[model samples]
Target: MELVVARIGRAHGIKGEVTVEVRTDEPEVRLAPGAVLATDPPGTGPLTIETGRVHSGRLLLRFSGVADRSAAEALRNTLLIAEVDPQETPEDPEEYYDHQLIDLDVVTRDGTEVGRITEISHLPYQDLLVVARPGGGEVLIPFVHEIVPEIDLAEQRAVIDPPPGLLEEPPGVDGADGADGAEDGRR
Candidate 1:
């Protein structure tokens, strides 16, 4: 299986160092030195990782043979792909890959069907499960242990204990003025 591990950002330094937006949970393992990554444009790489370092909270990588800023900048926005065994799983049992979570049915604790997970949006803070609703719409459920309590791979479902209003529409939509406690026009 091929997984997108990171995306190349602008060149960080003059000596062929490029910033990367990491996508995988295990950057040390996936983006480590000497690891060769396939590029998105399909022609730029198979870039071999010569060195890696953290600079001001961002991951910087130096690819083999890329000796200058122009060469590094040329790789900007290119996605780094890593090959993995299909049978291999994460070291942490609680952690799951994006492929494993996608297509799983999402339901509430009481078995109320919510949706099916379509995508996993990885942000700096947390991951969001993009669910495609049954009736035709989408909801972004935060993929946290508190919100998503259980993930049953055997059952092919994710049990969510959503807080009140987590699954509801936002304010001022379809006659929903969001008048929860402000019944008397108070702010």
Candidate 2:
């Protein structure tokens, strides 16, 4: 599986060091020196990490052959990808790779069919499941434990317990009448 480990940020100095927004949980393992990563814009990489450090809670890395700030600047917003063995899993039992979650069937806890996970959006604060709804269109379901109570990978299903009005249109809008409406537009 090819997983994105970091995104190249602004150049740090004249010496090619650039800050990165770490995307993987195991940065120490995946972003270590001598690691060769594939780049997203295709021919731009196979970049090799020459050195790395941490400053101000952010990770800084210098790639082999990229020796100046100008070279690093060219890589801004570039995604660093690592190829991993499919058999390897994260150290934490609760943690999962994005590849594992995509394509899982999504269902409500009470057995209502919602959709299937088409993608996993990794945001800064949280991850969201992009479910391809049965009725067409998609819904973003927060991948938190409270809303997604179960992930049965063996059965290829994710059971979600969405809050009210999350799965469909709420009451009283677009021709949906509320239990009580003021007699007419005059009200």
Candidate 3:
């Protein structure tokens, strides 16, 4: 279950180079030369980084066997992943992957079961947790320490104390009206 760290972008130059949108926090360390990577939706063979260097901002990478612009272009938009051991543990208690947060039970400080985390949005300022309820519409809670007081990934639960009016339904909006109401609830 290796996590995705980068995605191959468009070809960089006339050479075998291609632009890679690095996803790791430590891009320089992870996207080094000679790094073995696996592609998804899964290619015929593994890709080896023959050379990798920062250009402008994105990583310029040259993979072994990909020696032409057309060859490099073929890998565009392909996700690159490294083999990560599942047994490896996180260094910090607060640090958790987005996949780990999905399906976690969301509750209020007063022990009110609000919903379950259906999706996570990575915004410019902060990440947002989309909680899906049984009857009520999705509650968009910002992923901050104040709003999300606690996260027990092992238990698959989160304790949230959202700001006032954060979870209230919009005025004149009802679930039974049509898809518009459901669509408006998302905004």
Per-model C-alpha lDDT, please?
0.94, 0.89, 0.82
Residue 17 displacement in candidate 2 (angstroms): 1.2
Pull out the clashing pairs in model 1. Answer: none
Query: What TM-score goes with each of the models?
Result: 0.90, 0.83, 0.74
Per-residue lDDT tens digits for candidate 2, residues 14-91, read 999999998886889999999999998877799999999998888999999999999999999999999999778787
Model 1 vs. true fold: TM: 0.90
Model 3 agreement with the true structure over 19-89: per-residue lDDT tens digits: 98766544565578888888897962479889987788667999999999999999999999877666554
* For model 2, the run of ten residues with the poorest summed lDDT: 178-187
Better of 1 and 3 by TM-score: 1
Backbone clash count, each prediction separately: 0, 0, 0
> In model 3, what are the clashing residue pairs, if there are any?
none
lDDT of 1: 0.94
List residue ranges in candidate 2 displaced over 4 A.
170-187
Tens-place lDDT digits, model 1, residues 66-110: 999999999999999999887788989999999899999999999
Best by lDDT: 1
All candidates in order of TM-score, best leading: 1, 2, 3
Worst window of 10 by summed lDDT in candidate 3: 174-183
